[model samples]
Target: MDTASGLTYAVLGTGALGGYYGACLQKAGLEVHYLLRSDFDLVQRQGLVIESPDGDFALPQVNAYRRSPDMPRCDVVIVALKTTQNHLLPDLLPPVVKDDGVVLVLQNGLGVEAEAAAIAGPERVLGGLCFLCSNKVGPGRIRHLDYKKISMGEYSAAGEAVGITDRMRRIAADFERADIPIELAEDLVLARWKKLMWNIPFNGLSVVLNATTQDMMANPDARSLAEALMEEVMKGAAAQGRAIAPEFVQTMLDHTAKMKPYRTSMKIDYDEKRPLEVEAMYGNPLRAAQAVGARLPQIQTLYQQLRFLDAQNRGL
Candidate 1:
């Protein structure tokens, strides 16, 4: 890739996560093209409005396109879309990604990188685990709650460890230039499992019980339940040869305890009657564990509950 200023970036999904990161990059003077949907006209008119704890800012004029085909081929294509909309990547990716450009899967859940690798080629794929608390409150308006760090790593087609690379550092430089903290993960598989240690409990319980992080962490019973679920996640990770330290669970708990009270992305989807990413976030992890003969009863129960609630919410 090129230097932060020289490389052009395309944000494929301009929602909370995409819009916030893309806006930061553009504000830092990087060339960023946003592929917008519902907020296209508004962002094109007013630009993106970011309400962040660090400070509020606005991009008065942005390079916005309603369709991927209309966008300029970029050096880095950031796929920040929700996994539910991933089916669109077949059309959205090829039209905007240069022959040698890389696609950064800035998404949640496990095995999502594979889908992008299939479209963009394995060597041209990277994974980003966004540790951000943000939401799109209105058209072109994104509210950044807390936690704005990303753990990025390269994708290995053979499922082997790809240690830190110059390519990874180059990408990290761009994000760091945008004032975003970047942790270069040596092992992407272990990093994904670590992220799941937090996502599985908070994302699911928040929707199932109608509680925020504050509510869950404040109540003794809810706090205990969350920790128990996290332990099961560790067990599942170990089954796959990823050994997360027991201390990591407490670290996650403490982090969430300090986080601002906010509704999770899954909860927002549930409230909006959109399809929950039950399959990606829950079902996929469960299956992975089961394939290795790991028994995760608590996680299995939560997954089933989310499945039922997702169906009922969507009227499926």
Candidate 2:
């Protein structure tokens, strides 16, 4: 479909990431439907309240639904659910997405786009790597701490480069209209691996060591360990034909250093006793590396630790 004419969006997961972005789009005068779980009634009754560094805003009225089948079939579906809950997508996607609509996964970790592709079809799937620091503080309320940009690209079944297409450009336009910066990536796989350079270190260490971003960056030993994990992620990427630059490691370190003292999503999940996305964030990447004869011992150790922690926390 020609989204330039005006695209309607369905936000499948209305939490920190999804709620913030969907509210932004709706506030910008675009049609957006949000699918909520526990807070569906609260959002529908009170609407969404966003507290951001940019500014504070509230949507007095929102298009909120408790289920996908209740929402109108939309031109674009944004999947912002944590990978731990992605099993719901197979049943949640088809009902609310138009026949020709696309699914844009605003998620972290590796192989997520492929999972979405399996549900929505390869050509209809797009990957978006979000660099947002936001949290759902309460029902229908989000606190946006810092950084809101997305790198997006079309998905390829072969994991090859798919340059920017009109579909991507059209989607970028809508996000840009809502004041979100969008970088068009030529290779989705490379972009995902690049994201892991930061996610692998900070997200994993945050849970295992019970530290925040500032805590890890402040201590010399923790900082060194984080960098080593990043190097392993770089190696994993290279093994998969995505050669990340050596300097990119330092770039991620610098970025995290300047970021606010915040707990990563995985750490927050662990703290809340919610299921951590151990498999998606760590397991899949490790397996991908091992498949290509690349050994990431440090990352493997971290992955195992996280798995243990997740099982113990959730009582599995």
lDDT (10s digit) by residue, model 2, range 31-150: 999999999889999999999989999998999999888999999999999998899998899898899999999988888887789988999999999999899999999999988999
Each model's Cα RMSD: 1.9, 2.0
lDDT of model 2 at residue 78? Answer: 98
Candidate 1: tens digits of C-alpha lDDT, residues 110-158: 8888888998899999999998988888999999988899999998876
**C-alpha displacement of 131 in model 1, angstroms?**
1.1
Q: Model 2 misses residue 247 by how many Å?
A: 1.1
Q: After aligning candidate 1 to the native by TM-score, how far in Å is the CA of 273 from where it should be? A: 1.6
In model 2, the runs with Cα more than 4 Å from the true position are 1-5
Candidate 1: segments with Cα more than 4 A from true spot: 1-5
